[model samples]
Target: MRSQPWRPQRYATTAVGFLAALLAFILLDAPMVQRLEAPTLDWRFQLRGPIAPGPDVVLILIDEPSLEALGGWPPSRFDLARAVERLAAAEARLIVFDLLFATSSNSDEEGRADAALAAAIAEAGNVTLGYAFTFGPEMLTRLEDSNRPPDGTALQRYRRSPQAISPLPHANGTLLPPRSFSGAAASLGHMSVLLAPDGALRSEATVVAFEGTLYPSLTLQAARQFHRLPRSELTADVGQSISLGDRRLAVDSRMRLPVNFYGPAGSFPSYSLFALLNGAVPEAALRDKAVIVGSTAAAAVPVFVTPYDPALPSVAYTATVLDNLLLGRSLVRPEWLRGLDILAAGLGAALAYGAARRLHPLAVPLALLVPGTLWTALAYLAFVQWHYWLALAVPLSLMALAAGFGALMRSQAEQRRREAVARERQNLSRYFSPAVAERLAAKSEPYSLTGTQSATVVFIDIVGFTGICEALPSERTIELLRGFHSRVERAVFGHGGTLDKYLGDGALAVFGVPDPLPGEAACALAAAAELQTSIAAWSDELVAEGLPRLKTAIGIHHGPVIVGDIGGESRFEFTVLGDSVNVASRLEGLTRQLQVSIIASETTIQRAREQAGTAGGNIPLGFHRHGDVTLRGRETPLSVWVWRPAEESRVATRRAAV
Candidate 1:
């Protein structure tokens, strides 16, 4: 078989597809695609279901009931002090406030209440206070006035060049706890949350560098204080892990950590502040747990947009991150892993192109479906099984585009080829069945002249055709010819034989002409048998209609023959011409002398017998050897065989019995 010619446009489409994938990968961080990623990440949580929250984490929520029972908002600092005292007495491992107390309440007794809250924190000795960072002008001015020199006291020191400072989230100002309140807490951490482009808060700065000093996030500070890690033991490098004693925090270059929420709001066990304050909750419930105290009252604290919930209490984000760090289940997508995404996209595009090119035009979509589905499953598994954010949309888009584009190109090319072949098939259909016409049209070689191949040639003619036609009017004679042609044509095509042409009272049929048949000789014999049966039936019908009976003699021979257009190009006919064809015609004439409806050359008989031996019962007719005789064009004797229908033998047996 000849190879197809190369077309650059086909590959150009594939190239464009691959480039499209690359473009998607590049735009992965764009606002639109990133928004797409958020839900995909959320899908992993949905797929994994809710994982059990860490055993050592709990929330002491200042919820609606707590405020209703306590009879106030912000619950005076003195009231918070009482709650802290209760938790401290309960032997809580660590206490973290997800609240801001940067100023005193504008009341006369506010000073005393602030002093009481400071005393409670100093007495607890394990409390971590939270503060917020703001970029407002007044906050910036406050930070400028209170700007402390770079402190060399922190443990998580970052490696930076003399002039190259560590890149961190910059905040002009912070809403600090009151002086007394800040000094009493064991440590203070910033409660800053970073919202994604879609305004969903899915991550937070692990640590923020401000005013020449680094401040750990509220979650990080809580984890550190709980683990009792010294400042000297904590260390971090830009774009690397922050090690604090036994816990390691994976952060991006900007010191951001993706919040892996365990579930929707209320995933953690919560004890109402009013219950704890009133001794309704037991110390056993608080023992050994890191307690996070925050307001769940909608107006007091803003809700966070998390994967699990859109209006989750802001404190849940802090608690989830703390839980993630404590359990070492952090979700991190290292900078280097994006390369894998690119590689996957490139490989997917290459495979998709090859599959489209190799597969049948109709099967290209099916071929592309396998890879597309497998890649998506793998991406989900990467997130679920391993806490890695494998970029999916970008690479998957590339593969789909490339595969689809390649398939489209291949389809277009095949469509053009089919259109050309369809035109040729129409011409061939005039002389052959549609099946044979398609085969001839599909061949690379032309049907006009210049072909010699092994084939089975058959000649079928009406017995006593001249006398029968002369007795009928010209119109009736033409009708008889039409009926004869239909019967012969049906038999030939029904048995995979090609009807080559009509010859007035006879017709030329060929087996294995346009294309080779597995058993051309057997097929020819079968077609002859079918033609005999059909002629008998038609004769019965004609006799009943008061018309002349019809019979046909068929001759078949298997040998080499010249097959192509025989007439001049101006008016050519696709037909066979050779000694083999002449022999078949002679055998048809001999059918009348032998008193049989069908006769075949010894060559055809041998071929049919061989085919029958390979595939049982390929030849259904009973063949009897006929005496050899010299043909008109040849001096040598040509052996022949006669087909005696089994029905005739059966009828003779019945007559004898009668």
Candidate 2:
């Protein structure tokens, strides 16, 4: 046996799979893969269902009903003023508006309404008004502000060194609340929403850098007020924690916080502005809760996209963020996650490689599914139970791809092995069984005898072949022999019997060679019957073609035989050399004396009957016992049975009785 040379292609498949996983990990933030993360987040929400919002937060919606009652879109400042007054009277802990009052109101009733709203804010003392940061030609063309801080005292008290970090987005221009409203309000926060590349709101910028100053987001400002934290104690460190008294948040380098939405829109308790102004809302619902007032009417306010809802109100988003902070629960993509992703990909690659290399080809598909299913389950568990979002789409896909690649590579290797065996079988077919050639190809050992084994040996010969060859032309005789050989070969291979060798007008077949299989005797008998039927059909075809009709005789014997590769190393042949093979050949010669197409020794008949139960069904051999006779080279006489079809046997039995 010779060893095969090392092939690089063998390891290349696994390497490719692993490298693909690494590539995907490195490009985790790419736009193509980022889109996949959305569905995984959605899966978490769907699996967990809806959770109740934190008890300390409430959403005050200026909904369609409010607009209808106020006579149209954009409720008058008076309506807003009365709503604010109601909240103030209820003694709410903090009130933050998602609505931006960047422009002044009209004269007459509007001016009075604005003044009234401003007075309500002054009275509340905990109210924080929203100021947007817009970027457009209108703002660029206009004269810039004096760069005055809205909350100068608080800004100066909590300001960090300007050179420490610069992660917040620099605004082109600021949208401040009307001076009167700003002066009346206790604090002001920016209401600039950040949208993901896919147009979904997944994170919130807690702070924005503007004109050498940092501004807290609306949610952050409202939360700070609720905690009653002084401006001097608050701190913002980029890529670190944002400390407001005892409530500290671990934010990303961009100072953005991931929002774990409780549910879809309207998950929180909400009361319409009309209901509040009409005294329909209970005072207790507003008391001590972090209330967010904003328009849910799409026509009036910007309709933002969220994981659970596409048309979520901006105010609801702010409320959810506040809820996340107050509850100290938010999805964090830690810095170490990249390393973890790489580890997962590496593990998947290893599993895929192992499966492809060790498992059977038929089992490859099922083996590949294990990693995909396991990772998905782990990802979901991490998100729901641990609050860690592990992106699995890319990692799992890469794993499956690797597994498939490995399977393909293995299949190609197997195919090549088969082709090599097929070429060997073509040559070996001259002196060995196809089954023996296949077994030899599979093993890395020299072919040899495995001692004595019970086998069913068959011999087939064309009757009167010598006379037919002498009478016909050489070409016609060769064609007839070729046709006879083809018919015998099909019968042998079809029944799982091995075509041992061709002997001019005769051929030898053996069963239970290379590997022992159940029903070997029965299979050999079946092949003999097939040979007779096929040759009979071929003889009829020859007669129709104006050629001589021919007949064949087959003999089957089952007993111990010494089977192995015989002859020298330069030219060796595989064959069985024992009394059983000799008996089978002699039985074929006796077929002429008995005038029967098939003759099976008593050994073959008895073995076929004994193994019939394990062979899955009844044996098809129908034979009647023929008297025993001493065969040449045999010390003892052997009993034989003349093979006959079921119908022929019935007719013979009837004739005998008559």
Instruction: Give a tens-digit lDDT track for model 2, residues 215-264.
Output: 77777777778888776556776566577776667676567787888878
Among all windows of 10 consecutive residues in model 1, the one with the lowest summed lDDT is 145-154
Q: lDDT of candidate 1?
A: 0.78
For each candidate, what is the lDDT?
Answer: 0.78, 0.78
Per residue, candidate 1 scores C-alpha lDDT tens digits across 490-509 of 88777777778888799999
- In terms of TM-score, the best-performing candidate is 2
Name the lDDT value of residue 575 in candidate 1: 80
Local lDDT at 4 for model 1? 40
- Residue 576 lDDT (model 1): 85
Cα error, residue 103 of model 2, in Å, equals: 0.2
Error of 2 at 623 (Å): 34
